[model samples]
Target: MNDTDNEITTDESESTDSEAIAALTVRVVGPAGEPIEGAIVRGEGDGVEFGGETDADGTYVEEEADTSTYTIEVDHGEYEAATVEYTHDDDGEVTVELASPVAVAELSVRVVDSAGEPIAGASVDAEGRPHDAGIPLEFSGETDSEGVYRDTVYENAYAITVDHEEYHPETVEYGHDGDGGPTVSLEPIEGGVPGASRITVAVVDESGSPIEGAEVIGRGTPHEADIPLQFRGETNSNGRHPDVVYHNDYRIQADHPDYTGEIVRHTHDGPADVAVELESGPERIPVAITAIHPDTGGAIEGAAVRLVRTSGPDSVTADAETGSDGAALLEVEAGEYNVLVADDIDLTLVETEYTVAVGDDPVQTSFEAVTEPDDCVLTVEVVDGETGSPIEGARVQADVRAENIDDMGLAAGEADGNGIAEIQGWCGEWEPAIGSEGYWPADPGRLDVAGNDALTVELEPRE
Candidate 1:
């Protein structure tokens, strides 16, 4: 009996002294305290053999681990890895808390027009650094019928810009506040023409009734001998001209030449109209003269009195003048005159300029004038600098200096998308100038007429 008892005691002692290996029991669970299955658990420590997988109960027991600090890594798909550090307690359990992954936040944006109406089919995009730099983490969305756009983005700060054709682009910076996220509002763009101020002009006849077809001209400040003018459309039958004029005070002049010329101070504000009256003036007559002899340069009698009117297209030649000494003289009504001196012998002629004021009687004037036709045409293009592209809606101007001509001006033209522009009615030696916002003033002064049919000008971009 004593021997049997000693044998049992020795067996118990052998089992206790054989080995004192440290063991650890780890558990893997989700944030809800539910056991997560299929979780991979790895243990790292001195004498620790790493190998683990959570069972149905999300529990993994690591046996034979060293009695030192051991770290447990539990990973499940989509859920962030849970790490737990502990000193194995030879025979106990170490519990670990693993935080669940955060879900992505969604943003909803709405874009509206200036009238507070929802704008559909508008593009919305994140604007700053990471986004504008082509980082994929940035988000963008398009507005739907309800003007609402939705996008799921990681929690972060972002700058946003909204664009639509009719309205100006709007921009703002937004950040997540941890509560779902706030709605972003975008303002609409203004009208197509930038900085186009409105101007209303009243067109009135002698009786104050709006006269239709009367043109309104708004001239800009003069720069380098040329003042830019915007031509407003003719008055409607109602006599009111609601036009979009450039923002500038203008020297407004109204003319129906058969009528009295009216000048008034005008701004880009409300309707402005000046009254004009028509009066009949005496008919204008033309005068002509002739030179005689090829070498003597003397006037020949009976050279014929040929008078011509220089106002309209048709040249009205009436009386002719023969040379008395070396030149011929002809009589005509006073006002403005362009007298031509010609002869039967050599047809050597010249045009003389003279202005006849009131009380100036019809008189004789002589000249040794030469005839010359203009041989050059000028072409110009206008463009915007911000976008190295053409500006379709700019105006081009040309100033011509012709002998005996007062206010010889041409019509204003609108540029095409390619910034190409042309004018047909300009003649003589003239200076060409092009202007537009975002572009520099064209080189002013003079452009020589050298038999070239066309002149190409590239306007410098504005700073």
Candidate 2:
């Protein structure tokens, strides 16, 4: 038989003494020479036909068969069918070898400690590293009492990791070997390396009550060099936070909403003790300020003014835009501050640092615009259209629009005895039409002041 290298030996149970058809024993073997039990075997010949299946030993016997050549076919689901012919003159023996269709890779792992003893409760993993970011293939198995883990995987590079609570983990690559399973060895750590200790901080308010969810920042300072400390964390329900830091000098800062912040310095030789109590926040009061033109002594609308705190619990800034009446409200804290004005197209007011103390009803203060040399002088004259005479004490208005500026300016004034109203230094395009108390523009189009040194427009009283 091609399957068995040794000569087929006959057993006494298969011998037949009487002159009758003897039995033939057929056995099936796999590609690895292992018996393929439960495989179907059929014997067919001219005027001879018998069908049976392999037993537990991959053997099938046919009783009372004639002495003639018969085609024996053996088939198993895992292997291809193999056929062979045998002449059954006496008790005969046959073995057929089947070929394997495909080959697949298998991986098995054994985990052990440094003492060469198997360790239970150890985790083992085999992961496949893909070519691209297409989800990687991963397989996981745990060690049993014998400390063994096995899994079937495709052909690819795999990484293996072994972990245990009391042992230092062992990580290695365990794939691409030719059908041989790899074993990993993990060492038990006697004691882990010494780690840094945490600096505990507790934040409280002026009333000695803990403030939960406060922002706490710790910085290592007092260094001989110019290095800066950078660390930030937040408090828990107990208003206490612990941060890993070195034993040195540090500055602890804490702050919470609706409360003033505090900064304290402490030295850390051993366990550090740092506690800070913050004062209450300042009381803020609302005050309004007005902006007036330095030359015209009139309210200048659209002036960019901001009030900044000079000294207080916290530096504060409040911004306001002037309405048509040239008035802006400021939410000023009880502290000294300087009112700031930006020079724009509408007015050439220099950045003035005029300081003022905000008190209760500090009254309405006025800021005058300081004109520059490149100011656009726009003048408006209000007069009666029928009489062609000067309209004295009439409200004259001028609106200037400039490109590349966030705010446009409106300058308003009353007509003089000669029906003249004047404005200075407004840049870019402007619609200069005279508007008095009872008079309309009563004109067609505005003055084209694209590059003009002086722009003058007249107004007429409405019917």
Candidate 3:
């Protein structure tokens, strides 16, 4: 009986070994039904290992006998991993369809101040290896009230930066394994002003009553400057205060520390003492200007212009220097203006007669001075068609009689490659003509002079 039992056991063991020895052939296909070569296929089973790479046709065959349910893994760049489970059988074939890997790495980030309090609305950025690997990647998210930010990233390494008002920017490095659930922490910079600016301000309450103890702050570009102002000063009981500030376009913010911060833009010139009612928050007025050059029909640059209000003794004026594009901008109250543009070479004193209505928005006005009419000069250029060369020394004539008409009974003159011929002191009507070898008799009637200034004429080729 013992001998029989040993024989049965040997048979069972041999059968198990044969099952494990079976080999598998894997074929990889992309979403488009095209073969994907160079994909790695790995399989392991029952303490046995087998692996191979797909050929040019995306086909791979592994010769191994580990049959106890083999796990096959396939890897391709930018594509998600593919896995399959199968009991190996002799001559068995398996096909793997891999999906593209998610290009973004999903991550959660949290920002806290030095005191470990959550910082809301903080900007968070993630950058690392995979990010530096020349792949198209971008990370963006804002921290919640709990100081946590959730974002997705592609597989790679990256550096992260966080920023908030009243704190310095913080940055760190991180690497991800293409899996989720990684929480990043950022340390908030302390005491440093994130951004701040200052402006002379005036305030009043809803009933036109001056509200004292009102705190004033400046936001936007001013806040980002080197010397940012966290707090300027509180409005006096009469709603007035003396404060020196840097020059900049600013968004004014007022707060009693007990009430919400109200924001408004102070674009007007000089010291601002506007009345702000508690019931009505803030008001905005757009400002703009225009510049002109009458001489060359072009716009003037660096020209200073001003808008002066026509109201009572309480008149306000806004000033601006023209830009390269010949334009200026000035914010003012909604009213009329005695507009003035500083005179220049091309601009006569009379050209300064320009005015605009400074409405709630911007206003544009052009300035050009009229001049006396004078004689007009006509210049004609003639070129040879065959050799594409200018016909120099050729005679050009005009039918209109001048004191010195040339011997050809034509007001003729020699041509210069610079084809410049001035009809000096010529007024009223005239005609034109050109003379050259192998050319038709050029007509002198084609030239016309109307007003003062210079005129240009190009003679067509004569067949």
Candidate 4:
């Protein structure tokens, strides 16, 4: 028996003094214990230049290997290349493990409208991605040909924002819950004008009886710009004025020749119906006020008419809203008053001082409410900074100041279930403030309408 160091006795060589040639068998397997067929198993440095690929069972055999150090190398395109070195002294078998190449994680985003229709040309932004900050915020994409965006990203928490001109934005923090990514839904900017959007006004008498044929009128309130609210047909037999109106509030005046007219403030933000009650009185002359656009000759529907007592006993104060005919009527004792007139949207109006004499004949008056049209709007949402979760009940306020249109002092609203708040949005530059309990109030900041039509207000908790 040749027991020298690094010597192997073969079956052909029975004498221990002879130099024996050793053989080696190599078996290659993958991570799952499956055979790696295409792996190249090479044995060198042993005076035996044997190189062969693994077979179906990942086994490679070298029949003749000398008693010397050998470097066994395995090369496969699909797996990491590997090599092992050892002395071959006898018929030896070794198992080589192959590993799969590392793969990069990826995520995708799809955007659609409230109607489930894919929205093209919508901008998408993502945060906490591997890319540089504001890279996606500035130019992620304007939605692809399929209205979807897919890319490799950092394996961590992410936030997505989608913006479109004619829709409210979609914003959320994201996680890879094995679904690849999220499909976000955006709400379309709904309803504006008489024939464009939807607004319902209900006219009723003191007893809650529907007043048919009662003229219905509405105009933008201070919360909105001086956009006109135009309605053509009168109330049907049901006394319900379901006309198309913008997403705004209006001072609605319902009038009937026999019954007294009533002025009511109604908000037509959503689908809720507004109710107006007309109080009937025994004796009253029609105090008619015609609010009109001097340039277009269109009767202004939502003019705010306030009669302040300029000179009288006690103080005669009465408020009325113009009807669809641009006229308002009220029963008042003959007195001197200063009629301060302004559009419901705070349009510039003339404050006329006049004297009222008790009479059956209608006292006619006319005032002009001039304004430049503005259709700007914005949407906002609040969220927690740490958890990246939506925060409900947050108060949001937008200060609107546009000359020739209207000045909305400070339109405020509370966040809803989705943490979204819709204020009378403004175009141009505006200031916004946000706050919630246990959270640091966001400092008031300027927002420009040129780029961001929607904004996310993230609140950091007070540690």
Which whole-number lDDT from 0 to 100 does residue 237 have in model 3? 73
CA displacement after TM-score superposition, residue 446 of candidate 3 (Å): 22
State, as a TM-score between 0 and 1, how close model 1 is to the true structure. Answer: 0.23
How well is each residue in 1-463 modelled by candidate 1, as lDDT tens digits?
9999999999999866754566677777554355667788888876555767878876787767656677777787746777777777588786654555533455677777656677788778884345332113455767999877776554457687776655557777777435354444444333342334666667576666666666666575532211235655666787666766554567666554234456666654434443433233344433334544434555556553344556655554444556455445444444433444444422323334433232254454444433233434455556554555777766776666544233454524557787877654435657666677766767556765444445444556754
Q: State how far residue 431 of model 4 sits from its true place (Å).
A: 6.1
Best by TM-score: 2
lDDT of 2 by residue, 107-213 (tens): 66788888889888788876777744222267787988988886554456778888876677888886554565677898776553223356778887788777788
Question: Residue 322 error for model 4, in Å?
Answer: 5.7
Clashing pairs in 2: 375-425, 376-425, 376-426
Question: 319-355, model 4: which lDDT tens digit per residue?
Answer: 7878888776665545556665556554243333434
* Full-model lDDT, candidate 2: 0.69
CA lDDT of 33 in candidate 3?
43
State every prediction's TM-score relative to the real structure.
Answer: 0.23, 0.31, 0.28, 0.23
The residue-level lDDT of candidate 4 at 240 comes to 89
Superior by TM-score: candidate 1 or candidate 3: 3
Off by over 4 Å in 4: 1-288, 293-297, 300-306, 317-336, 340-365, 369-377, 380-431, 436-439, 445-463
lDDT tens digits by residue: candidate 3, 41-71:
8887677677878998988987655557778
Over 4 Å off in model 2, which ranges? 1-104, 132-136, 177-180, 192-202, 215-463
**Candidate 3 runs further than 4 Å off:** 1-102, 110-139, 142-148, 156-159, 163-168, 173-177, 180-379, 383-463
